[model samples]
Target: MSAAPRPADVVIIGAGQAGLAAGYHLRRAGADFVILDAQQVPGGAWQHAWPSLRLFSPAQYSSLPGRMMPIPAGGGYPDAAHVVAYLTDYEQRYRLPIIRPATVRTVRRAGARLAVESSAGTWHARIVVSATGTWWRPFVPHYPGMRDFRGEQVHTAGYRGPEPFHGRRVLVVGGGNSAAQILAELSQVAQTTWATLRPPRLLPDEVDGRALFDLATRRHRATLAGQHPVGAGGIADLGDIVAVAPVREARDRGALKAEPMFSRITTTGVAWADGSAAAFDAILWCTGFRPALAHLAPLRLRGPSGLIGTDGTRALAEPRLHLLGYGDWTGPASATLIGAGRTARQLAGEITAQL
Candidate 1:
């Protein structure tokens, strides 16, 4: 028999940047809440990023609410490990109530409260915060013969670096920043082909995450005002292919060139639109991810585009639920570390008022 469910005024279903931010505000409001994380350790998805991955934003811009990330050795952008350390420290510094190694399975409405069932146990809360970000749900699109392909295929979630791909023929797929960064590295040690729906667009070398966040904020505000967005740049404006040292080297070597996506994948490699084929040892799909919303499936709040309709961060259908750090739809730049804090603060205020 299972143990009796614990009770809380609020239950947050992720302990990453989003959840942590919410916890900061909930605590400040003196609301009773608990944060649950699936990962055994802290740092959220930062713990799983590739070895060389670095934040495009510096420490100041990458921090969560009430705490700044400790600047790294050279006062430059923090790498993956540095980020992990910062997140770990943030949780500790704040003394947030976080339960780890708890994999939430479902969230169901029970009476006037929500029952969050997880491996660790169960929690009943008056309000639920679904903050699980996109890292767990990598989305790889379908292509003909993909099932028949014998070559190794991996999504960016599983890709570490070029060491394992040394001397192999690699096809790096997608046009986003992750694709560009991975392709840039894979090209250095492996014979690589970058395939994209369209050519990749890169931001100016001087523009980094801070600039991108400003542009995104401007665009978001313009949209709200129904004005012609002068800050308009497509998705690529979000720190696309930061001209980092490695990426710059790759660019100079002509490794940044891209090809149109092929029609299908074959046993040996990919087949082109004109029925041409090229052999490859592997294919890396950096095609991005969907929000990790499976645990909230019981709530039935998601609609088209796999998003929960929201007024800001509060679910439209379920007023007691708030989704943080999913993307622009939830709040402007909420998926980013810096932006999550802003959304969390606002959402906490709303929740506090309602409660």
Candidate 2:
């Protein structure tokens, strides 16, 4: 038999911003740990973002811990490719111990510690940092006769750009940022139709010079506590954020339409609950995503609204292996790249203390 696998002090899953941030702190503390990533390369979901898409937050807030993104003077929004490159540079510059392409299939509690099962095999660690952000699992709504529509159906994860639907009728579903961003861009080429489950409230992407970000960090908490309500309350209305950008220009071009969500699809195209069906060449589903924690075994976890519960309602619901990038713990910024650094730092502290 080969040598027995070495047990690490910590094992971090998903090498995104939070994972990398934890790695940064762990390395600085000289802790024995491994950062395991499922992707072939780094950058997490940034690698999967639409090629032309750029970060809404200016570079100042998008940097990782200890280092800042080398942003130019004027306000500039770097695209997805730029972000991926930056993460690569961040990994190299910081010498983060990242193991890539090793997808984690399961994480279970074995007595006191946690056992991480990945494609490579099993890893036993004193503590685990589940830095898997809550955006990968797309929320594709089920419909009656949805599969029979015959037209192509894809989610935001599958969307690359609008060039595919040039001069064609395309239905973009959902009312969130992904939907808005794709709608504003696709309207230039395709006859676009947007649908929502309900009329979503809209807020400015940035208010008082702040881009709404993750919900579990300090900045997010301060913004929430100071504000009348927390969050953009979900998706922002087109009219709210359209004041200072090209969104207004797109609306005037006759390519945009704001409406309630699509209920179903028909032979013609898609069917709305209000007895409306229109012709469409393709349908883009930007319906957002759900939290995926199915891999956790033995350790009980409770998920409501796609968020893991840390508080004790039923003692059995405790997550012996806790999750960090779940949602608004420390406020809105904790869940996003702009403020994930803070969450990662907190997680590192928790892990250090646990070990």
Candidate 3:
């Protein structure tokens, strides 16, 4: 027989950085809550990242409230494992009630209580924080003959490091950081080519909080701060903070060519928007991720887009429902841990006020 069901004041649908940050404040405020993470460990999104991954930023901005990420040697990036370890420690230190392997399948509001159904069972809470996060589902672009390929192909999520493609021709099929970072790293070892629909822009990881985020909170709050200083002679101000090594090298080599975006992905290779096809051994799709929330019903959402879209502190039509760490909707610093903490703290106050 299954154990008895536990009730709580709030049921956070995710236990990643966002939900964990939210829980930190919830616990501090003496709020009764439970964090339900789909994964077995606390490193929500990091678990799916490539093995050789490291924080683009210095470790200083990455650490959470109660714990510190151990500095890696030579001041390089911290790999995905380092993040996993740090988040594991954070959960233990806070004594947060995080239920593991409880991949939430559905959520709803019946009468005044919020109900969450997961692998573990059903949970009832007064409030629900849809922190399943913006990056719940990895997006794999549908292309012709994707399944007909006779070789090994995987999402960037499943990639480990350059060892897999050592001395091989590698084709990275996205323009985002995952595609960029991996492409740059793999280029040093293998013949790597990055395929994108648009001319990709590499962004600087160092986002200035005061100049970018806080500047918008109250003063120029409506506008995103530090969005590439004025007169910055670069593409969308991304070139300033980020140095595009591969693209520059490719530029000098006449190998870098961009289409209007990827149109299709055949098993052999990618087909461009102009109906051109390129063959390859493997293609890494870093298009992006979508949230898997189709199961959650009765929760009215205002998404013309396919997300629980919210501006951190703002409520949906449902007052009890809040969203955290959902891209730039929350705050300018939404993607960063510091921003998540600030947003979660505000949410704690909002929840307290409702209580």
TM-score to true structure, per model: 0.96, 0.85, 0.82
lDDT for each residue of candidate 3 in 229-258, tens digit (9 for 90 to 100): 343332344342233344345445544444
lDDT of each residue in 161-225, candidate 2, tens digit only: 88888998888887666676788889888788887766544444344114344322334445546
How well does candidate 1 score on lDDT at residue 137?
A: 95
Query: TM-score ranking from best to worst?
Result: 1, 2, 3
**lDDT ranking, high to low:** 1, 3, 2
Q: Which stretches of candidate 2 lie over 4 Å from their true place?
A: 1-3, 72-75, 199-249, 252-255, 303-306, 311-320, 329-331
Instruction: Extract clashing residue pairs from model 3.
Output: 143-265, 197-260, 197-261, 212-225, 212-226, 216-221
Reference-based lDDT, each prediction? 0.89, 0.68, 0.69
Off by over 4 Å in 1: 226-228, 236-239
- Deviation from native of the Cα of residue 344 in model 3, angstroms: 0.9
Model 3 vs. true fold: TM: 0.82
Better structure of 2 and 3 per lDDT? 3
Find the candidate with the highest TM-score and give its number: 1
lDDT of 3 at 15: 85
Report each candidate's C-alpha RMSD, comma-separated, in the order given: 1.5, 3.8, 4.3
